[model samples]
Target: MNTKFEELEIKLETKQAISDLGLIDLTPIQALAIPKMIDGLDFIAEAQTGTGKTFAFAIPIIEKIKLVKETQSLVLCPTRELAIQVYNEFLKLVKYQKDILVAPIVGGESYERQFTALKKKPHIIIGTPGRIIDHLNRGTIDFSKLTQLTFDEADEMLKMGFKEDLEAILQNAPKERQTTLFSATIPQEIKRIAKEYQNNSSIIKAESETLTATKIIQNYYVVKKEDKMKLLERLLDISNMDSNIIFANTKREVDEITEFLREKKFNANSLHGDMKQKERSYVTSNFRNKQLNILVATDVAARGLDIKNVGLVINYDYPQEDEIYVHRIGRTGRAGSEGLAYTLLTPRTEHKIKQLEKFTKTTINKLEIPSEKIITKALENKLIISLKKEVVANTNTYDKIINEFEQEGISKDALLNALLDKLVPSKKVYEVIEEPKQKKSNLSDFDNKKKDRKDSNRKPSKLKDNAVLVKVNLGRKDKITPLIILDMFGSIYNIRNNNIGDIKHYQTYTVVELSSKGHSFINNKTFKYKGKNIKIEEV
Candidate 1:
């Protein structure tokens, strides 16, 4: 039997909010934690990411909050991204209550803005430990009126060396407050925190054995690192996915991948720490409103975000942490809906797959990279489906055109083929390359060579006849170093260190010699870094 949110004894407003968010059924974590939290009991929940953990606590906080002129609930997260994400989720839950106010306190933004928000006497406070502690030290925030507190991603916080900050906040907070700690994994530090702070806390464990929802179809493809983007593009072309989030390891990779996707005519954006708050919000809003179909983001930038209807999650680069792998794939297969997660792996990272399987307690099946023929067939099938829909909607209109063509001495079969050709243009699909049998080493040698090149004052005129002088629109003024430019080009074009040529830097632009082939590959393509389009042209 399935449990619904309505069955819980929450306020009608909260119930309405849940319905507004289109949440009909309660997830396992929510089902187990909401009641205990509403009863004002302390809790220590072991729930994985994307398990609707935010709502497990947010709904109860909204139901029990008194809407006083002071902070009644305080939620602490590990990073500013997660803090803002939690604040946004709380806002959704309190949409029906006009009197309720929430504020997010995190580092990286102006302190004056936080001070102004604190002066408003928000009913709830959401922030990271460091920023929250900063507010406490300045005597700008008071927790005397706090009735409930939550440590979201508690294990991550401790791992980030926030034990003293957490202890300071807990010491100042009222002991009678309802405390809750939620973590994906309960390390010894988390256990210690729970033992010391929580009073008779109801320990609820949503184990990793069921961490990944059964609805998610997980698969991985083994390919060379250089061929990752090519494989990714092929998958995107053939998968018929409506919405996707591609995870990369660094901000540079996120920007480069997003730029590549946009060049391919994909409605894509990037989210990373380097982006300002406004830009991040804009990208997120566009994604939510369907203005953007793909969002390339780093793990930290995407934490605690709950975007709806994400049909696919692609790990373009394997994550360093096993837990992060879970969170990356967890973005899909949400809200009882079916989703697909694909990971691109190389021989060097193939062993991580087994570790991931053990950590997630779910089998990640091996999948062969799709061939050009397979992709072409998939594209044809999609076009046929679309043509069928069009005919079903306006059969009479198409029938008239078909009759005219038939009367003009055109056979029905020929007319149909022409229409199909027009609907789905014929294009050359790249074939999947087989992985080499040789053992591949890490990129330390490439990194060392890049570092050496960056430190050298090389001139562009010394390049070979095959090299072309290319100008890029970013320079030292924009904090664009030589290595950054190299990384951008290398990531987008999958070029090696030797393929690059001489380089020169300027105040507002840089000129570099690229192999004629490399120059042609990106000749008319749009490339972006830090959300700014890089205008490239051969000099």
Candidate 2:
């Protein structure tokens, strides 16, 4: 087998593209599939996600397409997210080749834009089945010139109920076109499609002992639903992950998690089905460029995304299906590189952990939540390291400042402590404790708060001279408890709990007290809680 891409006898331009991508050697799937693809043979490949399968087929398709202004290849994916990902990969491979145009045609995007792109006569089209069928029906796409067709994630397409769409596409394509199908599993549906469309096709499978690669270390933490967010924050703080993807089950969860992380000042963003095409593109591009540190996305939004150096993957919500669990964790640990995956589970979902471990045929070790002491120590260590770097980088400035402080009768220790306090403010550290059981006082406390608010004519608590009252359009109706609001304001705006004076919850609105600085930060800024935008205004 050829180790380097140049050994595959590809054009110099294609080889240069590979080198530009900084890929020195081919992955196992790529090493196996690229040679046969380059030989112009139809085949079915079975490989897990994150095995560099996109390049396996893309390199050959790029090599075979003529420079003529006509569509010569079609790559069909299950979702728009996957389609765009494939198109982006094609763009990278054809970066130096100016004549080749690759267009993504997917649903939920402007048809006018896709039609305009078709007018340019792209050499390759990557899209979903439904959108491709739309173009085919409208006479907007010409498959007569097509020479190669690929079905990426074939099993997923079938699962997404695209079997009819796939049939329509295959039947309409020219019989002379070379067909290739790639899937994680060789189910009967995939085999049936292969038997029907592929001719004399080779079957290549990258065999692995487990569903998940051995390079990925799997772990799980059990916590209550209410404490999930706190646990996540602690895990991120202790682990100090560089690049990570957090997967949720629904778009709502994605939005909520993204909002929470952003409030906490983490470089985070969200991607899901509800977002427009342009918005999705922006998020994906930023993530690929490392401008975003954390991406909160649903499974559909992350399908076929192949960003490298994903140090960790957090399954904030346990997946419903076994395959989803496999795919979610597969985002990390690519190309034989080591990675870590953590799943947050509640007591109700604890049994599912065992089922997942059994299904993956791998061990998932239980991880203990970091203690408050551990987190505080980690923060201290980080602060010391950053201070050391600053001191090394500006020794003369620090010396001058120290001498000035000395002349002012200030001790060096006192000067440093003052500087440290300004740099890192003390906040309440989370304790490594279990969720408290429900108590009658909880309800009584809520009732007393409500009574007090009503007695005070729904006015916020007496504020300091500079304090301001701000109203948020979330209340008891939307499960907006006082604790939730407090956490948000404290984390997002860096307002200490003590600084948050009074919170009065109404039917559809809530008023809270904030210091002048906190009020300024919230004055013109919009906040999102649980996917709904909340307009904060002075009352």
What are the RMSD figures for all models against the true structure? 14.6, 18.0
* Alpha-carbon TM-score of each model against the true structure: 0.72, 0.71
What is the Å distance of residue 207 in model 1 from its true position?
A: 4.7
What's each prediction's clash count?
0, 0
lDDT of 2 at 56: 90
lDDT tens digits by residue: candidate 1, 404-507: 98899998899877866777847655755876464654646444345434434443333456887776777756877658877888877776656677776654
User: Could you tell me which 10 consecutive residues in candidate 2 have the lowest summed lDDT?
Assistant: 436-445
Q: Taking the tens digit of each residue's C-alpha lDDT, what string does model 2 give over 171-245?
A: 999999899999987776688788889999879986564368789999998888888888888877776777889
- Error at 114, model 2, angstroms: 2.9
Error of 2 at 198 (Å): 1.7
lDDT of each: 0.82, 0.82
